[model samples]
Target: MSSAPTPAPGTSTYRERLVPGPAGVAAVVLFAVMCGLVVLVSSTVAAAITSLTVLVVGLVLVAVTSPVVEVRGRELHAGRAHIPVDLLGETEVLDADGVRTALGPGYDPRSFACLRTWTKGAVTARVLDPADPTPSWLVSTRRPAALRAAIEAARGA
Candidate 1:
């Protein structure tokens, strides 16, 4: 993936929506088809309506539930949580192995992690606020390097 374009000072430097992949959509569609086929053995019209409704509802839920990651002004937003850029320590981009470890045995109980199995990379940042109980944040992303750069730039600004 390409790096996110740098925005003007105090503007959003990066933003991304973690939407469902094609495979996930396909799986939902396939399940709808299977349900339709089973119901078709009884009533064709009912089967068609049921499958259509299921497909529409399923896709809508998936889309609406997708998380957003953004770096705007002096803060970083991951899903519904936001933190000040200045309060973050060195941000590191992690590969698949590092992500696995961070999410596994190396994980800190006090850390906040927004993870998705589909996303391959992640960025980890230590929290600098001594009073806060949370030690760090682990954010899953498709573009870890871009996120790290955005956070670093925002911190500098």
Candidate 2:
């Protein structure tokens, strides 16, 4: 894991940048190569165009799919949703089975999720307010325990 960022005074910050996994990378490459081959079989001009098109598509997919999780200034930012720490209850690390449950049967449509198929572990934050549509927040993380600790620190738990 990389070193976490330090926020200014009065804030405990934890930021993580999750990029495409090995499999994702492979998929992108395979797509480009396969498209190139298929086009090359037809015409060189079309193959060149296909190569460029595939490259752009691959980059866009990875860029849009990447998730950045951060906790700063009493707020938790996971993907696009931003929630105040005060509204959060207990936060914990989720293992493989726990992740499956949280993302599967236990999933909430309103919950904020930046899930990635490549990610194996996650961190869950319970919503304290029943009125809120979201029951909880499930965020994919490479370092679930560290993220939990960061949340605890933010909550002064």
Candidate 3:
């Protein structure tokens, strides 16, 4: 018996690029204005601290919402976090109901590691190991289904 031939390596079946939506842009702009106000109204030391904090936070937010999924070579990078090609498993696109189910209660936290709450949908990728520090990432994507398919295909699943 003969098996079907495999496609060329590093060839991706789907690809999607996600950027900040209107809400995210508004947030960045608002934060920037607030930082400027701090500089305008306070001492240089205070301004420096406020500006630094804002800058760091803004960068992180931008990073998180930068791109939901990228498939290149044999790897997949979701948002600011990177997931190895080999460890990836099944992929699913979550609609509103799916998001609620996957995230559970208090899904949106006010600070640190909080996935952007305003995303239209999410892509959940299965992980291989139980002890892996990189738990499944809930990525904010405008095109969640496409992103999930791309990730799954890239992983050769």
Candidate 4:
């Protein structure tokens, strides 16, 4: 098998970094607390099994969320999702009201499936393919404007 190419220093190419924010930290802490509680409420054997399972799953989530976004060459990877730079079209930075309006009905903030509610705002990405059911993705970000600009620049390249 061919070895993977190394990334150049100070370049956007092949870079993967967490989209640093309070949400990730809070999630880790919350998971830890929940796991602890589970251990406290269970029998010795049950506690050991449950705690180990939770620890593994929680660590995986921490790893995934720790890197909010990763730019690997022309691809952008974000929280269990990935998109090609070329496939990205228009971008919009939206506030709470704007996000609600843009997302339309069926929006539920509690679900992790959607962007975390702790996010002050979001960056909405437009997909190039008309046939794609997911027309846009709402990303929670501390700096929506900056994220939008970065994605736009990547797409332009």
Give the TM-scores of the predictions, in the order they appear. Answer: 0.88, 0.80, 0.56, 0.55
Cα lDDT for residue 123, candidate 2: 88
lDDT of 3 at 64: 63
Candidate 4 per-residue C-alpha lDDT over 10-121 given as tens digits, one digit per residue, 9 for 90 to 100 = 3464333444356665666577657766777657677667666776777677666554655555555667777776777777788988777766776544322236666667
Candidate 2 Cα errors over 4 Å, as ranges: 1-12, 42-49, 104-106
Residue 18, candidate 1: Cα error in Å is 1.1
Each prediction's total of clashing residue pairs, residues at least 3 apart in sequence or on different chains, is 0, 0, 0, 4
lDDT of 3: 0.63
Best by lDDT: 1
Better of 2 and 4 by lDDT: 2
Between prediction 1 and prediction 4, which has the larger lDDT? 1
State candidate 4's TM-score: 0.55
User: How much does candidate 2 score in TM-score?
Assistant: 0.80
Ordering by lDDT? 1, 2, 3, 4
Q: In model 4, which range of ten residues has the least summed lDDT?
A: 7-16
lDDT of 2 by residue, 60-147 (tens): 8788767788887777788777787779988878887888888777577888787776778998888998889888888888889988
**lDDT, residue 42, candidate 3:** 60
lDDT of 1 by residue, 39-129 (tens): 9988999899989988998899888898898999879999999999889999999999999888887778889888887889999999999
Better of 1 and 4 by TM-score: 1
